[model samples]
Target chain A: MAKQAPGVRIDGLTVVYKTPAGELPAVRDVTLTLEPGTITGIVGESGSGKSTMALSLLNAVQPPGRIAAGSVEIDGLGDVVGLRGEELRKARGKHIGYVFQAAQNSLNPLKTVGKQLLDLGRSHGVDDLRGLVREAKELLGRMGLDGARVLDSHQHELSGGMRQRVGIMLALVLNAHLVVLDEPTTALDMITQANILKIVREVHAERGLTTLVITHDIGVVAEVADRLAVMYGGRLVEQGPTRHVLGAPRHPYTRGLIRAIPRLVGDIAEAQALPGRPPTLATVPKEGCVFRERCPLRMDVCDTVDPEAHADGARAVACHAVTVKEHA
Target chain B: MVVIARRLAGHLARGVVMILVVATISFFIVRSIPGDPIAAHTQKLIEQGMAPEAAEQATRVLYGFQATGSLWEQYGDYVAGLLTFDLGQSVTHAGAPVTEVLGEAAKWTVLPVLAGTLLSFLVGIILGVYAAVKRSGKLGDVLAVSGSLLHGVPQYVLGLLLSAIFATLIPILPGDGPVDILYEPGFNAGYIGSLAEHAVLPVATYTLAAYGGWVLAMKSSVVTVLGDDFILAAELRGMKRSIVFRYIARNAILPLFTILALSLGLLLGGAVFIERIFNYPGLGLLLIESITMRDYALMGGAFLLITVSIIVANILADLFYSVIDPRVRSGEEVSA
Candidate 1:
């Protein structure tokens, strides 16, 4: 048996948010492993809790949103769920660098980029004053931006594309073991998106940094991800190698998502639009599969019982309708 | 530095325009009323045993107010006097210079307002930030509720109560005037002590009245800033809470800065009700005197000074804003 490489291991993770109405579970019983130097993409619709799962790496979930149960472990960093106060803060950017969804707001509008970057480096106790400044400038330069100019100018002084690139640079500056990007290219133009993806691939190859890309658009993630995990209704429905999973999505939900993307050459009318909206945590069925209400393959048995994942090699899918043969 | 300079210059030009506008409006408003400064003075002269024609001629020459000319001609004389640093004579003061009257009153108003404003900012900002960043427990609730509740109480009501408690009930501080007459008005320690003792109630009255807005404003703004992504980013960089607070609090205090500056301008106009309550000799008392006697030159001078102070304060706020906030400093860069 082959052991998984040293990277992030999120096990039995459950996140519940305390809303005015009641306690609602956002991400439920999710487990996944991101191996070293590999790009793992978590694809889902907006409410699927993919971002919640990603932000849990830093304990960065905002107020009213909290991790109810689970532990997140990085190679040598130990349990993230137990760390608190200064210990938790030190472990954050040092262990995992997060590039947030909003590129424009990622940098503080008040301070120059140079001051922010230097402060970040110095906070980590980097004593090479002159050298660090040089590296900081070069880091932005590597992103094909005017490093010197950006260092002096405020955040709003830059174009949107340039700001997102600078955001990516901020994450890499810390050189964390796992770089978690939550919808990094979502707000960017198509050209900037492609440029950012290329930079991500280049940085990954050069630094051997394990990366997690969480996005709703599967087509974008498919370009650079080595593996894929599909989330629906707060649960991980399917995960395997990126190409294989995209080619043959075993779960009905994953198949529907892939079919929903419009092809330039394909007939527009034939696009398979998923009928129902994603279920809220409160409306999730207690007696059957969470996706049963929307699943085209739902049967009488599916309505009465919950389905569990059946694993073959690294591939796992939580669909009762699909029969699995034991790997030889 | 250049940015601040440019912003200051621009505001100064606008401030000049603002002063001119204020002067024009106040000039016409004072005249629109029925009373005439020259006529009143001539009556005083005639009662002093001067012939009627001679009294009228002397009054006209002394005040430089021509009775036979159009209102515009009188305005031109006023402007000409102002250009030469002559604000005309006080009608009731037996020819005392209007500038001298306003100048004496201005010092008294400036002293209390300056001390009061500084005290409010220091106390309010500290309490507000501490309240926000505290454990978010019962103490925070107490701080928040009590602050706003105190703010709802009017300044004069608080001033009266405080005066009753400290000035009359206990007699710890003087109730009336800026300084005690027995002190002989010297720069010695005893004289200074007497002055401070008299100022205590007025300063307290002003601080108690003004600090509430700052506390409430700082609390809300700091809370909002704490939730900002920049703070999160700082924390993720593994910086201490104290460091994050330094940056976060600076941005949070911006909204409160403008409010404080404006209130300072109002107070300098002589927190009239507060001044009268404490019996503090300030511009408010002077203003009241001018209004009652209809001493046109004196009233005009005092009002003009108040308007200039307010305009200057606002201009300073505009300049200071650009200095503190990068978004305003680099206006050309924003929204690019």
Candidate 2:
């Protein structure tokens, strides 16, 4: 409890949703570590288990969906995956906080913001409500918003941007070692998105809090992420420093994501869409690489063997050709 | 503030219009019925030692009989009389003031109906929220099934079944009226206790019949809300299970407020069947008595009171909408 800003280690994590007939795999053996005091962005299209992975931090993947096989190791708190009932609740309150993607849906409309803050604070065993509120007001103020108005207001009384900021503050209020924000800029305007990203960067730098932001927008991650993990077909295709990965993406799926991003001031390459749908997780191919069908440079060898990830320095990429034995 | 003010004014204006329409219908519809109360009144007047023709003319003038004028004039006068609570004289009760008769009957309906409906609402909300939060639990399944089963049972049938059990089978509670004859009607606890004891079956019937609707209404609403992101957000924040339930139930149950208020308004007409089955002295029983005894004035008075109550309840509900959600207070989605 005394150690500051704990690093989170997610090892061999697999989450699955159980239907009456069978289990639908959502995340497939995803192993990642959140380096303490850094901003990591998880970039993936919707339904890539980006949300499922984030929710597992809170142990809140709703029923029919469960953590099929995994362990989330916080630096001091041990494995969060196995905690149950009160222990799990205690971990959620103080260990890692999460911000939901939707602004209109991040808080209860019927309850006041003060009450919501109080609820979280009380659960974390902070008895001084007045002091807690004062701190919350300051938190909101740091985001360039009016503390008094936001504290007294209802969810509906805030703009989408304001609500998104509130969601971020909610995630950080507990002073959790790691904060996972799922698609923070998803529904915000361009200007609001820029402002929110700036606030996030400032907050992270000041508090030295590790944060994991999940988004499909490459531009958002580019604006803020120190490290990046690109997921495709429920698997991490590329993981490395944001600059290194973006500068020279190794995996074909990562290249597809980079190509999909529209340009602003660069060479103005013609923006091309990635063809075909993401493979259905339940019926995805188990024999070979999941991205083989969508890979631009597929080979007969790729079809026969599921390429093992080749770790190069801090970067690891799973591809037969790109991640060769003597690569880089 | 201005928008809420304007909306409130609009609601009150609508209420006034509804009252007027109700009054006119009550007055004119009774007159248009196959048998005339005026004729019945005239028959009595003739029997009271007056010449037949003079009796007809005198009673005609007293009752606002305008055989020669347009129907619009009659409607206008009837509305004007309703404003003064003048529902003419009852023919069946020897020309007793109809207002006096209705006021007495309203008491029996108001207390029991309110008690039953509010109790039902309380019970329904608790169980509904419980069922919603624990959707897959055994308790939830039981409550859901009970709600559906109870909703399917008619209020009268429930009342009859209660009577069959208490009056015929086991025989404990008095299955009829407001109290036992042994207790002298007074402000004493003995009379009140007996009154409550007698009211047991009737109120139970009304609550059992009504609570199911609230349970279903609240359950479905909460279920839909459970799917919303805010509920998950609440859980993610590590809020207690109780607070999470509040988050799910509060917003979802807001729409049920209007329905609750409207049911109160339905007390007059709706409570009749329940009251009749229980042999309770309420507006429902009075309504039937008025129709059978050909008491047009009393019937009109009862109709006016019931219609006015419904409108008032609806208007109050409109005001309460703003209270329930502050966004409504501003007359727009309250986003800054």
- lDDT values, one for every candidate: 0.81, 0.82
| Candidates 1 onward: DockQ, in order | 0.51, 0.58
Extract clashing residue pairs from model 2: A157-B334
Pick the TM-score winner: 1
Per-residue lDDT tens digits of candidate 1, residues B1-336?
766776688888888888778877888899888867677777879999999999988987776645576889878988888778888888767678999888887888888888988898889888888778773777777777777987899988989999999988998878888888887777788889988988888888888877887788888888888878778777765666666777787878888888777777877775788888877778888888787777878888988888888888798788778877888888843433
Q: Report the Cα lDDT for residue A253, model 2.
A: 88
Please write out the lDDT profile of model 2 over residues B192-243, one tens digit for every residue. 9999998888888889999889888888899889888888887777777777
Off by over 4 Å in 2: A1-3, A265-269, A300-305, A324-328, B1-10, B38-77, B332-336
